[model samples]
Target: MDANTISHILLPIDFSESSLNAFETGVAIAQKNNASVTIIHVQDNTFEYDHTNLHGNHKIEDNFGDVLNALADAAQLKLGKVPRLIMGEGPITASIVNTANKYSCDLIVMGAHGASGYRELFIGTNTYKVIKYASCPVLIIPTKKKFKQFNNVLFPLKPLPGVLKKYDLIRCMTSNNQETSLEILCLSSKINDDDEQLFEYLLDEFKERTEGVPTKVSSQYSFGNNIAEIILKTAEELRSDLLLLTPSIDISNKQFFIGPYTQRILHHSKTPVLVIKRNN
Candidate 1:
């Protein structure tokens, strides 16, 4: 998807500190790109309610609506501008994905952790599901991280066919800001002649595509067997504000799936990681 064409950004809020941070980051990006923000709060519908007591059921439903409205109002107030608020009820991950697709969101910005810590919404369950299933790009912000200038963006590159398509979204991301520099961190376990040749080819293609773009584009190679570790180290060394990753595909099963390395980066990266879904 074209970054310039990002008209809507989806932000799922659980009212946690991390969710709030993600909301702010979403708003920041929205304002910068003149995009609208859609705030959604997914209410889990798994809780059982007694159908025997009609009055009690009505009261519960009313309370749920009231709570949703209050949360929406709070989000709007904090956002400083009116945003489209959606109240979703069902499984959390499914609700988020459905809402995003329903709204035709171009991007999803969410927190990496919720009130229940890493094992909750962002890190363990919902976040992973969204990244794996969502058709659009997902930007995950850590709880402690704040909205900052994207001066440096670290993009981890793999020598796979049609990998250049992943960078198209990056162009959109950095289009408005001329100061944003994209650092391409190429990783390889062995620094052989073939690896160097592949790196050069990828770099050339990148340069060709991003020729007229104002953002400074550069490439670096890291010799490491562990792709995740190399990516994290490079990001930290550069003080990268954003990390871009195209998840590895596992074709071992009947259907392709997100690889474990992507999960590792998502769980460990201190900086916000923009996970671009591969064209499978």
Candidate 2:
């Protein structure tokens, strides 16, 4: 279905600046589509502290509930539409994904905080987990309001079925062709003569897919030391608004993509990355 058909959206709020960025973006989309939003605060009730015979578990639980309610109430007031608040005990990322599915949410708007090195391994970013696991479409609002016009989108493609099948996700963002311009960008590490012809053929196919729309299609192949850095640099050169990719990263050992560059992109790119799952 089209964006206008979205009737209900799930927006998770943590009261952080990033979450607020997500909330504002969600509000605008909800208003445009006349969709109601459910603001969720996933409280991780697993905090460990020096419980040296000082406090009881019941008291801590009550305190947690109180904080959640206050946050929820404040969010309800801020939103143009009254929102539903849900409180649960578990991992924040898993909780939000389950709740979104339980409520049959059409979309999920969230904040993305890029992580680096050891921290990213031990404590995963909630936005990364949500995008990796969530069933609905997720709009990742950047830390800063660095939203450029989508006249040129840096779509880093790979030889994966999910990447090609995920045209639906890109379509959702660029559905409103009247206001936005969409482009399909394919980034290749190495280009053979045959690959060039194949890439050109795929560009033609993408053009047909976005037929009768105010959109441009392009492809590029870069041979370099760091592919993610190259992609980001190219996007900066073009002044792109968004970057699209599968949530798959490519660390040397734990590659999200086939190669060892996805992690680099996730950690370093300033561009807003739309990380979709295999099924999404």
Which of the numbered candidates is closest to the native, going by highest lDDT? 1
What ranges in model 1 sit over 4 Å off? 1-4, 45-82, 119-122, 175-178, 248-256
TM-score of each: 0.81, 0.71
**Candidate 2 on 1-280: residue-level lDDT in tens?**
3432666778786654556666776665565566777877665656432221113433334354565566556555555567777766678888898988988887888766521122422213777677656876676766656342234567766443334555555554553545444455455556667656666776677778777666666666665456677776877887776777654334222322224465465556566666654444
Q: Give the winner by TM-score.
A: 1
Clash pairs (backbone) in predicted model 1: none
The lDDT, on a scale of 0 to 1, for candidate 1 is: 0.73
What is the Cα-based TM-score of model 2?
Answer: 0.71
Q: What lDDT tens digits, residue by residue, belong to model 1 across residues 1-280?
A: 4543667889887656677788777876776666777888776666443222223334334554565466556656655667887876788888888888888899999988754445532385677788878878898988767874466888887677767777776655553655678898887777878878988998888778777777677988887678877888888999988898875322223233677677777888888889876542
Model 2, residue 21: C-alpha shift (Å): 0.6
**lDDT at 140, model 1:** 90
Which segments of candidate 2 are over 4 A away from where they belong? 1-7, 48-82, 114-124, 146-151, 159-162, 175-179, 247-260
